[model samples]
Target: MNRTLVRLLQAPSIILLLLWMIIPLSMTIYFSTIRYNLLYPERSGFIGLDNYRFFWTDPSFFPALTNTLVLVGSVLLITVVLGLAISILIDRPFKGRGIARVMLISPFFIMPTVSALVWKNMLMDPNNGLFAAFANALGMQPIEWLQDMPLFSIIIMVSWQWTPFAILIFMTSLQSQDKEQQEAATLDGAGFWSQFYNLTLPHLARPISIVILIQMIFHLAVFAEIFVTTSGGPGVQSTNLTYLIYIQSQQAFDVGVASAGGVFAIILANIVAIFLIRAVGKTLTV
Candidate 1:
């Protein structure tokens, strides 16, 4: 009787959760199979697979896909490498260590839109920005970051925000590391690099995998940074898959194509998750 009551209590929340996820996904799939356009609601009807075909054939599709991959990969590399180094550096006891950690990790808590705006207006602006002022002081011309290097600028902004997250994870993991092993290595004439490679790296394997998985999931859907900074332009130069989908749905009013693109994004995310899951499993076993 108690078990039955417990099951009954759990059923509502589980059903609600299912409905929350299923409803939007079902609607997207249904929309993808039809000719739904906000601009032409009167002409909407069944158009099986046409939306997918149109989205796939879009000239910007491949470029958007490429940008998505590059952004994810570049940010992952930067965050993981820099996060590990920063975490290690701050892990040791020192003056103002707590304050330093707080300052270093604060960037991750900033809103993405706010961070992007700050980078665009305060740092990357060609004139009256920090980079421009520094360049002028040095008698060198300021480069147009958003115009000539839009994608790279986005990468740098994302990396700056996410590296703090990686550092937080790595720092926590380092706390649980086997100090005895580290002490033994040091006593046996192991230098800093040797100890890091042999002892610290192995201990951080799981945290690294977790950081990669989580960051990849978020980075694939990056929109605000690109939208706020570059608006996915200089002719789609900084357009990732998420921004491309936005253009289709909001700008072009093509719900069908946007839904198709959403479906593609879901598939891509799932593929990445599956691959990372397998890699994480391997790391766990090792």
Candidate 2:
């Protein structure tokens, strides 16, 4: 009776979760098979795969896919490398380490919109932005970071916001390190680099993989920061697949095309996720 009651109580929550998840996705799939444009309402007709073909044939499509891959790869690389270094540095007991950790992690707490806006107006501005001013002061050419390198600018912004999460994860992983092992290595005159490569890094392999998988999943859908900073470009330069979908849905007001693009994105993300899971099973598992 008790088991039955527990199952009965959970039924509502499960049904609600399914509804929340399925409705929008179902709508998108249905719409993708139709030619539904808000602008061309009178031309409604069944155009199975036509929307998909149109999106795939777009000049911006391939570049958007490449940009997403580059962004995810670069951000994850920066986060892991920098995160490992800082985690190790701060793992050693030091004065004011608590306060420093808080400062470092605080950037991750800032809203992406706010972060991007401040970066655009306050930092990346060519005329009076902090970055340009500093370069000018050093007798270097003030770079128009966003205008010249829109995609790169967004990558830097994302890395700044996310690297701290990686640091925290690595620091937590480091806490479980066996100090006796380090002492034994020291006795054998194995310097810090040798110890880290053979001992610490091997232990960190799992959390490092976890960080990469998790960061890649989140970064694949990075939209707000890119939207706020670049508005998808001076051209299509900064438009990732997500932004391309946004342009289709909103600017172009083509629901069918947007849904088709979204379906493609879903497939791409799922493919990456499946590969990561397989990697974990093959390499990380016992």
Candidate 3:
């Protein structure tokens, strides 16, 4: 094939992808600068920074941001710790390890929406859910999990779905560990804890940072669980930035505010990405 033809063929795919991403992003930025309201679309004008100002001043915005941080941070912490312990355990050849691995990995394959529904209606529901049934049988009150603990419920739901992913990454990283180093440490009378902390953990530093950053990005955009379960309800108590923007655009029909919120999310994600890249650069050189 001619080089020009080959280049032309690849150009279409790149162009399509760019258009798919950039068009919507540009639209969002344009709307964020206007006063677009679905109910009164004709009245929309260049509001400049009014929508951004209102969104920031909204009392719910700060709480939602805090909740967003907590949701992402807590899940990241849990999944990393559990993923490390599980990876280490399974790295050892034990009986039935295959079965355990299957079970551990299966959760990541479940659709997020389906997992959210299962948790909302089956696991965490206060009425007739498994938890509620067991609590009622034990003569205890069925706590309103989604209502009283909306953010926590989301944390558990998202963690359940994503922990398997963390495990897979950690296990892949662990498999690359220097077994000779571990053996040498063992011969040196270094106990398991000391060896793990000194050798294994240091080896995992790059991957741990990778996992934390990647997972933070995904967790920041967590939507299905919060949407299907709480609908960002209990008075927006569980509304993370994603859900907050969703409610603004979909329910409240405030496209401008939603766009502004989206810009905020992009800014925050970039900030974390920069930190992660710097951390990776430093650790890789060391």
| Candidate scoring better on TM-score of 1 and 2 | 1
The reply for model 2, stretches above 4 Å from the true place, is 275-286
Residue 38 in candidate 2 has what lDDT? 98
Question: What is the Cα-based lDDT of residue 285 in candidate 3?
Answer: 56
Candidate 2 lDDT tens digits, 147-181: 99999999999999999999988989999999899
Cα error, candidate 2, residue 199 (Å) = 1.3
Candidate 1 or 3, higher TM-score? Answer: 1
lDDT agreement with native, every candidate: 0.95, 0.92, 0.89
- Candidate 1: deviation at residue 278, Å? 7.3
In model 1, the runs with Cα more than 4 Å from the true position are: 275-286
Q: Estimate the TM-score of every prediction.
A: 0.94, 0.94, 0.91
Candidate 1, clashing residue pairs?
Answer: none
TM-score of 3: 0.91
Error of model 3, residue 64, in angstroms: 1.0
Please state the error at residue 20 of candidate 3 in Å: 2.3
Q: Which is the leading candidate under lDDT?
A: 1
